[model samples]
Target: MKIEHLTVQGCNEWNEDALILNERERIYGVLDGATSLSSAVGVETGGYLASRIAKEVFETSELPAGCAPLRSLVLMANERIRTAMLERGVDVNDKNALWAAGIVVVRIGEHQIEYAQTGDCMLVAVYKDGTVRTVTHDQVDHFDEKSRLLWERYSKEGLPPDEVRSRVYETIKQNRLKTNTSEGYAILNGEPELEHYVEHGGLNRIQLSSLLVLTDGLFLPRKSGEPTPSMSDMVALIDEKGLSGYVDWLIANEYDESQQGKYTRLKVADDKTAIRIYFE
Candidate 1:
């Protein structure tokens, strides 16, 4: 088995994303600290702090004899994050104040691959037969798509990027109420019910070529109407471009004038993180 990973700072001053590559424990994945909605507390951004807390949990949590390691670790991580907020005198009940993250973790075993996820980080499985399936869905896309449309509409009206963001700010705020609720997506926000919404499963080890675990930042960005490339398209891209090369390609896409227009992206870039595991 071989593992490769890449992480780059986006527009943020510091990278909010982190990777889990505990080879001794056979646990690996990606974590996207949910971008903080509020100002930083001291030098640490909420998103970055949340992600780091989770990273600590995965790195040091003991696996109990009767517990499911990945699932338990994720839940524990959430609790710790929430605890951190509480210690900081944060109003944990306020969605706006909650530090959060999206995580995709897999524990590779000799005969099977165990995985768990929440929020938007994803996992993709590539087979030996030239096929691929996105094992984890981008839970935040449905709401984001609405924001994207609004952003595009405002941009078409010749609004500046700042104006467009202002126009969509309320919608984005309203979407926060839905987080971890029935109408919204799951995230490790230290909410107790988070475990109910976590995505977990196992895959057979045989004939599996690789597992691509990444954050949404690693997704190939598209214009308003351009179809999101399929799982096969993405894996094939990584094959051709390689991990670092793929990130460069994404950066280039963001800068490509031909791709910019009525539906401009909300941000210039995001903290990109990814881990690819190849089965040899």
Candidate 2:
């Protein structure tokens, strides 16, 4: 396979995002780490620690000799996160106190592509016929939509960035509480029910032209009333402009003097991570 990848920090002091590429194991993926609102771990934030631990497992750990059980690796990572949290003295039962991340990973085989996803990290496939389809769902889309609307409302009311951030914090907190539950999205957050939320699947390799693995930071900013960004549009943009082209586009328009960034996106910037893979 031919691989082109990118990982970059946004406005945050630490790049809480990470990537996983193990050619020997034929595995590749992306992780979007998010720290708790009040978390401030010593050297690295909880988000960084969580994603970093998962990245290490994917990159250095051994898989079963013949099979690529992607979900097993995720479960291992989740278990490790649970242990790490306790070591750090975080209340595992308190979702708000523990770090979390959305991960999407895949193992490409000669005849099939196996994948596992939790949270909002995405897997998109472009077929030979120029058709594009998302292999996994956007776990955070529902909550993000509500948050985006809140950002739009506050910004439209002429509230400053600081005030808008403050106004939206509560909503973000409430949504954060809903993670790994029936009411909310899926994530690898050291929660007890992670197995139930993990998404895994296989796709015929012959039908695919390429695979794009991405974190939500690569998601295009949409205005309040505009159509939501679709997988087709994302694939189209990558076709016209490479992965780096999309990053350039995001940085160019992410901020302005009047507001933090686009009203649709709640933050000034977010960690960006993505990988493009083409089968041999």
Candidate 3:
């Protein structure tokens, strides 16, 4: 098997996205959200601090179960962000306000994959038979009439992104503040919906070209009228074009002149990232 990854600033002032692929350990992660606008770490960017510390913890830690590992990583990340905020003189009360949402993938064996995520960064899985599916569910607020009505109301008062997210999950008594809606719900409410399978299994027969991990920047719900590609779409694309064609398509589709600088403007261009894994 072979793994390839690329990270780009995507017209932002600072690279807020972070990704890691530890083939030796069979783990991969992509963190797209930022704690602040200026940096990934240090006094200026607590968000950076959060992501770096989380990545380090994940790289070093071993989990008897993938969910346990991911849960620990998120907690540690929150603490790291808290520490950085204190050192930078940010009020302790504000620490909880800074949250880092991401998707984590852990390969349990040559044949199995375990994943946990919050927010929009995604994991698209492709089987050997050219069948594809998304392991991670989208966490965006639905743009239905009710949601649109709420968005319009909130847009006037100007709620922070985190606040807006919490509001969307308001029916759930505890989806408050900077917590990750998916993971948090699992912890406070119930177990994560684990999707398990034997290593390769059916996939062992077909040639697996890639499993692309992308941040919300490459495909934002509000900005792009185009529907986000379904998992089936990804599988079909890989089957036909393979990695080279997919990469070419991604680069062409994502590098829009009009979209440039949107991230810095907080237009939520987010951050762009791609991880291509090939089964040899």
Candidate 4:
């Protein structure tokens, strides 16, 4: 197996995304720290800490050599985050102090591939037949469509980026009220019970030739009438430019201000992390 990965911070002051690629163990993960909550807290961002903790747990723990390790891994990671909060005098019960994140984990076995995901992180399996299937879906996308539309409107009106960011932050904060609850999306927020919400599955090793795991940061812009890039397009770009170059293409081609009206999103640039694994 060959694994290539990259984590790039957004245009923000700090990059909050974290990742782990253990080719030897055949375990891979990507974590996206929620920016709104992290910005509100005075200390280190919860998303950053939570992701680091999760990566460390996955790296150091004596995980069982099976598909079931995903659940136990998440549970242990949550426990570690809880203990860290208590030790730091952080109020674990306070939502503001809680580190929250969307996480995806993939473990490649000799004959199969196992995956588990919570929140919006995604996993795309590229089969040998040149077909692509998304294993995980975004949880937050549908939660605040109205707010995103309003932000787009504001952007079209020539609002400053900072003002637009503030508005979106408020919207994200409000939407987070549903996090971990029945009404909201599930995330790794030091709550072990939320593990049940994890979406997981397996694929036959013979069926998949490669895997791409990504945080929500990487997306194709929809130009008025132009078709959004398909999975094959994305894979082709990666094949031609590699992961870092692919992200550079996104920033140059899609995230520019001149492209605003044609390509609008909640955030202009987001921390992008991706892992590409090839079974050779």
Candidate 5:
């Protein structure tokens, strides 16, 4: 298998998304840090610190010889974050002190592929016939319909970035109460117990021609009234153009300042990371 990957920071001053691809070890992963609620609670941005911990833990950990190592990796990463927070005198009980993450991990084997995901990061497999199958779904989508509607409304209101961010933040904060619970979404947040919430699966290697792992930042832009491209359309675009080319088109066509108001998005831009692997 040949691999290509990239990570681009969003419009923000920092990029919270992180990627780890070790083709020699047949390991690929991505983590998106949640935006910080308050910088005063921690030594650095929660998202940045959490992502760094995840990457470090992943890089140093040994490869899994069993079902999958994602659960263990997330568990260790969470412990590292908690230890760091405690060392900095940050209150472990405070939600603001703990960083949360949406993560995806993939391990490619000679005949099979194993994967695990939590939160919104995605893994897509494209078969030789061009059929695309999603290996994991967005945990956020499991939110109540009312919450989803409210978010969509806020996204389309054309509010200032700060105002929009505040609204979104509050909503997420409220939602955090349910995190790792039966009613809430699953994310890595310094809690090893949350491992059970992760989604895992396996795929036959011979049936797949390529695989793509991406964060939500790479989604198609949605217009106020018009429908956005379907997943098939996105896969087609990537097939026609290379991964970089598709990303270039997305930024040029939708994210540029000149294109504002033409499309409605949760954020002006988001930290984008993607890994494309092709099996020969």
Candidate 6:
């Protein structure tokens, strides 16, 4: 299998987004640092740490088939983060925590793949037959009674379905109804924890035409009303425009310094990066 990848920082002056690729093991990953909620007592250091740790695991481990190493990687990353803080004399119980949103997919060839996701970053598999499918579950913006109610109210107010996610997320966070320890940061105080998803078998005949992975900046649920494109559309776009061209398109269109999307209030307009992997 051959890979094509691209990465860009957020629109903000400070870009804490990081990405890692281990071509030898056919593992590709991205981590986006959540630095926007400084008042919530967390640092962006976790994102970088998580990315490096995950990359190292992929590079070093000889993971067996059907074994998704995401949970292991997250556990390793967490331990490393905690240990580093202790060694640095930083309070382990400090209100400020560190987190990086990311998604990881390992392709074992022959149209077989497994994925692990945390935070809002997403992974999708596009089959040669044009089927678009999401492989990872979101750790944030989950569905609930209140979220559904908010979605209904906001939808009646002319908000698109995708745009409703952020509003619902904020409502849950700000109202303290979602059990978040920190008023503003879900991951702080452990309201949000990492989630792992795996799909095995049923991958035959799909012919991994393309794999699309993206950070929140490139596919903000509320932005452009572009419907964020399906995995099939993402693959089609990549087919039309090589990885470089796709990166250029994203930068040229989404990186306006003055532009703000519906979710801008809740999300930082950071640089957008995406990777497309094409397999034989």
lDDT of candidate 5 over 102-157, digit per residue (tens): 88988888898888888889998899987888778778765533444565677667
Query: Which has the better lDDT: candidate 3, or candidate 5?
Result: 5
RMSD of 2: 1.8
Give the per-residue Cα lDDT of candidate 5 at 143: 59
Residue 221 of model 2, lDDT score: 71
Better of 4 and 5 by TM-score: 5
lDDT of 2 by residue, 1-280 (tens): 7899999899888999999988888889999998877756678888898999999888984665565499988988998999998998888877777788889999988898899999889999999899898989988889888887888888889999889888788888888888888889888889878888899989998768999999989887786678887889878987898999988877766856454453466667899999999865
Number of clashes recorded per candidate: 0, 0, 4, 0, 0, 6
lDDT of 1 by residue, 156-272 (tens): 789887888987987887887788887899998888979789899898987899999999888767657777656677778889989899899988877677766623477778889
Q: Which structure among the candidates has the greatest lDDT?
A: 2
User: What Cα-based lDDT does every candidate model obtain?
Assistant: 0.85, 0.86, 0.50, 0.77, 0.76, 0.52
Position 33, candidate 2: lDDT: 92
Better of 2 and 3 by lDDT: 2
TM-score: model 6 vs. ground truth: 0.65
Which structure is stronger by TM-score: 4 or 6?
4
Off by over 4 Å in 2: 255-262
Writing each residue's lDDT as its tens digit, candidate 3 over 182-275 gives: 3332111011221221111212323454576666555423332234445566546645776456545655555666654222223334456667
Name the 10 consecutive residues with the lowest summed lDDT in model 1: 59-68
Question: In model 5, which range of ten residues has the least summed lDDT?
Answer: 142-151
TM-scores of the candidates in the order shown: 0.94, 0.94, 0.62, 0.87, 0.88, 0.65
Which model is ahead, 1 or 4, in terms of lDDT? 1
Per-residue lDDT value at 121 in model 4: 89
What are the runs in model 5 whose C-alpha is more than 4 Å off? 39-43, 61-68, 143-148, 151-165, 226-228
Candidate 6 lDDT: 0.52
Better of 3 and 6 by lDDT: 6
